[model samples]
Target: MDVRAAACRVEAPASRPLDGTVVRASGDSVAVRVAASRLRALGCAIRTGGAPLPPDAPAGLLRVERAPWISGGHALPECRIGWSGPVAVPMAGERDVQAACGIMHVHGRATGGPRALRVDYASVCAGVLAAQAVTAGMLALLRGGTAVRAATSVAQAAALALTQYVAVATTDPGSGSSRPEPGAERTPPFRSAGGVRFEIETFRAESWLRFWTGLGAERSAIAAGWPPFQQRFATATCTLPPGLQAVAAAWDYPAVRRAAQAAGVGIVAVSDAGTPLPPPPASPWRLRPLPTAQATEEAPAPDGRPRTGDGPLAGIRVVESANRVQGPLSGHVLGLLGADVVRLEPPGGDPMRGVPPMAGEVSARFLALNRGKGAVEADLKSRAGRETALRLAASSDVFLQNWAPGRAARFALDAADLVAVQPRLVYAYAGGWAEVLPAPQPMGTDYLVQAHTGVAALLSPPGRPPAPTLMTITDVLGALISAEGVVAGLLGAGRTGAGVRVETALADAGRLLRDTHEVGDRTADATAPVVSDLAAMAADPAYAALFETDGAAVYSRAPWTFTRPSDHRREEP
Candidate 1:
């Protein structure tokens, strides 16, 4: 699909003034056009034909455009770039970016062939990052900072998508051994005797055991499959015992589903391209302003030190209690925008913090999303722990969480609970299925949500069985949307002097990706050699500067670059 056509389909809310900023888009790249669309959706007036503003115009004027490449204080002309595919065009297309950044490598590892996502994944990501940069710039201006120029490339965005994988590849000695051998029995999208292909999910080992046992699988096979299945999220590869597949294939889908339900496991049949699913939310998130009468005034900095930074959220404080990729990544993005984020962990800290591939004292995957954040250990189930969280929220600008459904409310750490104590807070909930699916929702993990929403089908190559991309597509995109929503909520709160509630879901993220355009045969070259080695890719001078190395760990730099006029000046990326 043409990048611009696909970008035009991205849904954004009606325009509303975000401090009456005059945003403009002048480049023809997909990233530039989509950022303009998003800014317009956020209600910034787009300046198409206006008198050129004075070079020193106030901070409200913002521009978002694309560049061929941005690295080491230099941006090559769009026409001079020549690594991805065809050089005849001004910029590389999405497929070239995907192949170059190792996205296809990770995405196709389990699917038997490397292919770009049917959706314009990289361009859309870059566009969203661009929009986020603009929003952060606006926030910086509102917070009494100078105007800023931000730039991002599709390659940078693609590299950001591979951050977790890169972290593991660079830090873990045993990472390479986790890859599935050719023709090995893979996991999930299991086919039943009736020929129904589906995905199943359960975080608890006991539940997994029960689900498999209910399907009459041998005890040893069930045990053998559990570890790989559970670790798939972190490792992006699942090699299961053949007996498990045999057991699943012995029964019809109804029987398989019945066993799943009896075992408290979540199950969803892989959807087809023509399946009738609920439409995605008009916008990726729902933001509602709470009554101002109950709102608390913004808290003053405890140390009384003035915040100073080029990033938009210089002094904002965020309290995040989230487990996996979606929620933690949201906080990470906020941190990238200059927020001071403090993680709320359990008494022993998050268990994932110890999951393999250690970078210093923390898991490389965990650090990928949590690198500059502070941590506080608290048990939210206890009254004292709840009070600790409440106190943190009382002094914070945003409280972000992605606990399982009702888990927050059960512990009285829900949005309502937090907003009551901190009425000026932006309460952001990154959830799964968020009233979109019917009662009895499937597990809200990335793969299952993809299956339930037909994203697995949409991303699968032609003639291949529906398979979820192993790259955690929805989790990452959902994080982007979550951060964007939080920023929007913060802006609304700034305008209305009230707390704002922002809710987003994995289901919505999947829906957005799937429904963005009609599925077609557009895919990257499946026959091309898969470039799965991110560490090697990072070492190449073409992308080396986009990553930073600490000890043995490698981390992708922030995708967007922000600079003030005094620091440097550039009209394009």
Candidate 2:
């Protein structure tokens, strides 16, 4: 189907602002054009080839087109991109809004395994970059009160989408036995207690033992009945024989909650959230650019490049007090630009640093997202730590966190609280679900978001159980969205010299996944299934061209490249 036709089939909410340009094309072009459509909406002027900016075009113009290259062990169609001002483009858009989004489960040698879902990660990455560019452009406009020219290519956006899955590392200790057996399928681990079924994820053997003990049940009975591979789900059934019945008979959600809370275990009642979800912007993810304050000041980078700092975000200071992959990834990407990012961790450091697949004290996941950022050790719970963080916030352009609902307020890190101190700071939050949902305060994770938002259901095959996307898909998207909001908010602040609050919820991202894929009778137009799995995706000449090798390892090429460095002048509006 043609890209324009596919876009027409997209069902957007009536209230969604018609803010961006929408381009239509087909076939290989769909991938890039879909992302380009999003960038245009974020306040960018698209250009093709190595073309010079039009005389009338505004400053910070992005010249986007295409090229081809080979490096390392892989090849890819080069999505060459350049920015006029300090950075490329602002990053902002709903994950589900991009047309022709192709999601698939690929099983090939490139996947490193049969079950790995390694679809077009490069495209995902490119989409993320586009969001960043547009966000930056939006910020510049908010600051200078002028529109900036933003550009990107179809191939680059496609490559970015695919980057999320590449070289991903998980802490799950390869405990495959807990996965249900084919013929012995059972209800989800949600067991009925007091006539209510709740999802109790004890994926790990240790967590299973903890739940069992917390319920005052016999470990011996559990050990005797279930094998290593089945222990996680053995308790998932509705009925347990006499020997193993405490969890159901004696324990209710409240009782389990108390014990689990005390023991730091995981449990939640099954939510009834189904499709036809609330309209777009379903998540708390928000972008509010404050009015540029009078006498607003932007500190210069140590290696000064531009008065607005350097690179797109040059001197912007970001304090990232987030844990795990989702929130950190946002800050990491900002650092990749020109932002001065300072990651605040507890004195003991983020627990993720100690997760498996570690190299010394930090894990690959930590290093991957936290790269190019400074670190600070401060416990938010302590008064001294709070004060120190407040100081940091006061000096930063953005403050990002992923604490549970209201936790930030309790800790005096909430937007309202921080805005009092840093009136120009872009306060951002990324979480699992939206606060509007019934279970607003429930502990949310990538898996829980998948399970709760029906993503698992959609991914599930005909008769099998619901399955989650291969990686922390929602988390990554949420992080990227949140980051984009921060930049856009900052841009607005630069203009009005006022701060704004930005939010992105995993639930909202999940909703995007559902909406984009749940088009009734319009699936064919929204996406055309690609048979290429991980190996095929890896070997595809187009996909291969996207990768660049540094002799040691092959990875997705960075989106921004300097063609010829020179001072960029702004055009009069």
Candidate 3:
């Protein structure tokens, strides 16, 4: 869920993302051509191989076209959005239009049609978009207005020679490309909830009862037959919150739940997100970033080369069945920390292989999130792919995949299927549609989810037109979140001899993150500059009067714990 888009929304100073509906294609390329008015309103810009490309047909481009809207009184081969400020792509032409698009080029090797090449083409489109968004901030090269855009792709955009891109990969099952209203706070949140719970299926949640398995059954025999079964605590200790104990002692489930909800607390009654989860009064566990030791890096080695560390995860092994950014990148991060992450790609070298690339030896599109990891190609659709994945899972402590919803099950990568074979294994995922595990055919990605979840709306604040950020913000965030579950699940399985399966839907993370009021669609943006932005603006005015054209001076007392360098820019990093 893209929660950021939920907080604030204002009329577009310009309009864009003009209902660029995608249609069933014949083969390779899809086109995007919008009206000059709508395109200009959105402040939309298209760049190919680096410089600006005309919407009609940029030179050196393999394919280019526009989309048509029979309902909105427009028609074309593909669709394009006009320009607008940051956050949210306002649609035009049709009141509701949803299209999934991609590009295809005629290289004389055409073996399929548009729908057939959809996955491959879509991957390329997403890769390019992700790449551009990574380095989208160069827009500030415009003299004075500076926007700090940060993420993994700056290197890739240059490689691809493209500037910006967007995709509407998915829509709610019942939704029909309905654009957000003018005054609505950012986009509507695809997932929204507060005080949800996740209860582990163990003695910890056994109410007042305790499970003393085997030699540890200190109190189990006596408690097993106790008249008050829930209160039986023989071997294992039972812990509960002070508030919950009083309520439970009085047999008041409703009261306890009410109090917990009022306190903004999550209760886990069952492991399922849809179940009536009520946490058994245990204090929340410490939440933190899974420890990471730099996997690879440039350092002051004797030869000034990259270095590797034999950190805590030196021998840990993982298999990645993830595509694009969300899932595979997590493997990259883990690989950086000394984990042996084996990324499994389906035949065509992972959809990202052809997305785009940066200059130099490496392809830009494939470079952003895969600095450290091994690649293994397999076809789940073949006799070999399924066997390879299963074999890999058997030996892996963790398996991660983000192939939409239903796709995983079709490939037999779902948590239940994998856990049955590898009980102590951890399964991590990043996806949408609010399902922990679903069929994979669902069209889902950062763009559409950002729209549906309202995250795009949040990047831009009040009185500002929403902008679809170039960053796969939610994907990155979801990676981190999923990593936590993976680590914890692994730890639990190790400690309890149980490889607990863990699931994290994009929608679930979105709702959990939306606990604050500043989310997209939930709150109107305050339309004020942040403190840092304000401070930078203020500091600039003062600095201009004191600095010379060829000289620089930063006024400040030396830190008590440090000494100033001879030259500000001379310090070695």
**TM-score of every model versus the real structure:** 0.85, 0.63, 0.38
lDDT of 3 by residue, 1-573 (tens): 111121012111101221232221111122121122112222233322333433422111211122221112111212112111111222111110111111111100111221111111122222223222211211111111122222211111111111111111110111111232233222111111232221111122333233212112224332432321222111011222223222233423344444334433222221221222122111011211122211111111122113333422345577888865567655654554345788888776765554422223333334445545678899987768888888888777678887755677788767667765565566666555444223331245444444434443443445643333323445554554455445444433332334455555544433333322221122222122212111132134422221111111111110001111223121111
| TM-score order of candidates, top first | 1, 2, 3
TM-score-better candidate, 2 vs 3? 2
Candidate 1 residues 304-374, lDDT tens each? 23555446688888999998899999999899888889999999999989988889888999989899999
Q: Order of all candidates by lDDT, from best down to worst?
A: 1, 2, 3
Model 2 segments more than 4 A misplaced = 1-128, 138-198, 201-210, 214-274, 282-284, 289-310, 518-573
Over 270-361, each residue of candidate 2 has an lDDT whose tens digit, in order, gives 44336445565522345554334222334221232233544556667889999866788788767755688888899977876754444345
The superposed Cα distance between candidate 3 and the true structure at residue 287, in angstroms, equals 14
The candidate scoring highest on TM-score is 1
Cα TM-score of candidate 3:
0.38
By summed lDDT, the worst window of 10 consecutive residues in model 2 runs over 67-76
